[model samples]
Target: MTNYDEVPYPDFIHPATHPGNMAAIARLHGVNAPPPESCRVLELACGPGGNLISLATLLPSSHFEGVDFAAGHVKTGNAMIGKLGLTNIQLHHAKIEDWVTHPESEQDRFDYIIAHGVYSWVPEEVRQSILAICQMRLSANGIALISYNTYPGWHQRQMARDMMRYHADGIEDPHKRLRHGKALLSSVAQNVPQGSAYRVALEEELKALDQANEAYISHEQFEDTNRPCYFHEFAAEAGAQCLQVIAEADWGDSTYEQVRPDVASALASLPKIRRGQTLDFFRRRTFRQTLVCHESVAVSEQLQSADMASMHFVTSSSLQGDQITGSNGLSGTVEDPTTRQAMECLVAEYPASMSYQELCEVVETEEPRSLATLQTDLFNLVCVGLVSVSASPTEVRREVSSHPRALPLAREQVLRGDTVTNLRHQPIRLDDTTAHLIRCCDGETDHAGLVERMVAYSMANGGLVEGDQVVTGEESLRVLVTAKMTSNLQRLAAMALLVG
Candidate 1:
């Protein structure tokens, strides 16, 4: 096992791991669980604490504690917490086994436990320990999220991992190992004759690896312990620990509509758990983020419209005339007048969420529709990844301050040139101008001040229109700067970057 201190995993947010999202899914399945607003959260193997930090910032009432063996990650994460002035979250440098023995006193049990990227890559003892922590330390009606590599899907990826590991053996330096691994893959991908299945597989694997970060390759593929198991086997292990899987972190995977009709019919014959296992085989799923609760907790296998109606819905889609299109690569057009009207209303309040009842009221159909129909429409939108359902309502600060206050975590990330993770847990890559504008949103400048600073920064850094027509008049430049600032602020609000 490689010490993560050498090559730490990149700090990123996983929305599926968010307690609100997880709890919402659990509730939809008829499991009584704690609300995310003020729950206790525990994260195993929290590297640099980016995911937890994002959650803590958004849900200030919730308390978060992270435990990791790597001291460097803990230190860096703690430093970030201090800089952000957030006291609700803390990171400790300790092994999972050690932490379980002497848990924090503020909360004896956590409402949610997250172990992302830790289950399939650790030793058997460590894996069992993680489950034990969830079983023993999880609060009554708590939900635990564990993500791992699944077999059939990982069966192909394993071959690639083995090849990379074999080529990088005896390499001590992480960077050198990564370089050697890439070169080895490239050599094999190029030498294999065309039209060969082996060549095709290698090329496909290479293409996927090309987009991954070096640290990911080093720790994920090159790590000593990488175990991929069948979905049933994982479920059995959880059952042994007195835990039962309630749902997958991804809602689409849990629904059969996403699968072909014939395949779905075939899977319908098996028991629910077995059906999931068989579906894995059909889909060749490589990874899974499974959500579990104590076996004593009763959970419904089916989702109800009432459950969805109780939740709030949000989407980043744009409506042009009667058509609603998603920016997140969600396919299909929404043209039904009722659905279209609801979607348009949601889009108008971008980055904010509307309750199902509110949506119905706003649409005010002449031929009043049942809650079931609205629920189905919203679920369809969610299935296409165009919309998200949340247990809590979104809090947006529409009033731009004298110096508008952006999210503190986002401000820090922008200054450090890292991708900004929004409240939705989606990463946004900002250009130089946008990044500067975000940094300026520290709540010190009013609208005029912001425009003035943006103009000065733009003029000093070679005005807004570069390599194109230049605005000669000072008055025109200021007006252009003001309009640009307003548009940028609106865009930021849409991106969920503004904080109340």
Candidate 2:
């Protein structure tokens, strides 16, 4: 076993691990899932509790627990929890084999169990143990999210991994090993011809590796116990433990819209699980975040718009004129006037979600549309990644406090650095101005006090300067500061960072 004491995985949020998403997907598939707001979540091999802690901060009513073999991770994560004053989550230092033997582990049942980045990195025995834990410890309607490196696509990456591992063999230091590994790839990439298949693949892999964090490379590729399996193989393993495949965490990947019509037609006739396996081959999917439930739970393969009635819909994508085009260009154009109007209404109440019925009522007066058409449009939006559906509605605090408050976790993170997890469990990158604005929202200052503090801070920090001249006049500075503060506060609220 590789001890993560020396090189720990980065503390980060994985959207797939969010209970709200898992529960929503389960419900979409016809499973009666637990409510995310009050669920009990257990994560195996949760490094430093980064993902779980973020969830704990956002959903204060929910309970979270994490178990990892790394004592260093446990200690550091516990300290962070203490600093944040979160009593709903905890971290434990214990190996899977040992942890499974505990009385509490046997007695307690979790509504959501997450094993991200663990299954493919461990031995078969450990993998089986994880599945057994999920089968034994999961609540009746609970879902377990397991992320792993999948096959067909991983075959290409493995060729590169083999070369890197061989080149770095006997190198004691991780940093030195990483340097040598990159050098080897660079040499090969430069020596190969420009258009050969091998050269193209090698260069593409090298570019990806260069962009990834050193810690990720050290543990993910160079780790000794990496075992990539086919989708059927993984499903078989889960089946043996009495868990059935529900659906994938990323809903978009499950569709065949990206493939040729002929290929998709052939795949459509296959069985549900077999269709997934075939799609993986055609898509060359290298990784997956799979969600599974107990064997007894019947999962619906077809998605019905009626299923979305109980769910809440949210989208950060902006509407331009009467079209709701995605920023990523993946979601094909939606130009229906009624659909555009609905999107505009949703964006106005940004971060918060309106139920399907509520949305219909709101837009019916402007352009009356059939319920089926509305549901179909919403589903299309979800497929394109322009919209997100959740089991729990957004918890918006509309009444700003005497001292307008932001999320404590986000506030602390902004003070320390420019990246912070928003209340929606998504990371928001901050510029200097935005970072300062977030740090100022401590719930201890009124609007005037905040404006005064921001003015002084901006002047001292060069934020108030336009080109070379500082806006120093009292009236000018106040107007500038107030406008900037209001804009940022609205943005923060839209991002779901503000709290009452």
List model 1 lDDT by residue over 1-500, tens digit each.
Answer: 33788788888678899887898899988987898999999999999998999889889999999998888888889989999999999898888887555345537789999999999999999999999999988998999999999989888889888987898899888888878887888898799899798888888888888887767777888888999999999999999999999989997786575678888787877776898888887788999999999999998876655678788888878777766678765556766677878888898776888888899898786464644566788887776678888888887765555567888899998876658978777678889878888888887778888888788877777667735777645566689988777778878877888884
Give the range where candidate 1 is weakest over 10 consecutive residues by summed lDDT: 98-107
TM-scores, all models, native as reference = 0.91, 0.91
Stretches of model 2 off by over 4 angstroms after superposition: 101-107, 333-338, 364-369, 397-402, 415-417, 447-483
> What number of clashing residue pairs does each candidate have, in the order they appear?
4, 0
Q: Candidate 1: which stretches are off by over 4 Å?
A: 101-106, 320-322, 333-336, 365-369, 398-402, 455-483
Per residue, candidate 2 scores C-alpha lDDT tens digits across 1-500 of: 34588888777678878888888888888999999989999999999887889999878898999999988889888988998999999899888866554236533889999999999999989999899888888988999999999999999999999999999999989999989988998899899998999999999899999888788889987889999999999999999999999989997876786789999899988887899999998889899999999999988887656688788888877787856655566545667656677788887777787777778788775344556667788887886688888888776764456678888888777765677887778888888777777778888888888899787776677556756777876667778888776666777787778885
TM-score of 2: 0.91
TM-score for predicted model 1 compared with the true structure: 0.91
lDDT of 1: 0.84
Clashing pairs in 1: 402-445, 402-446, 403-443, 403-445
Measured with C-alpha atoms, the lDDT of residue 90 in candidate 2 is 85
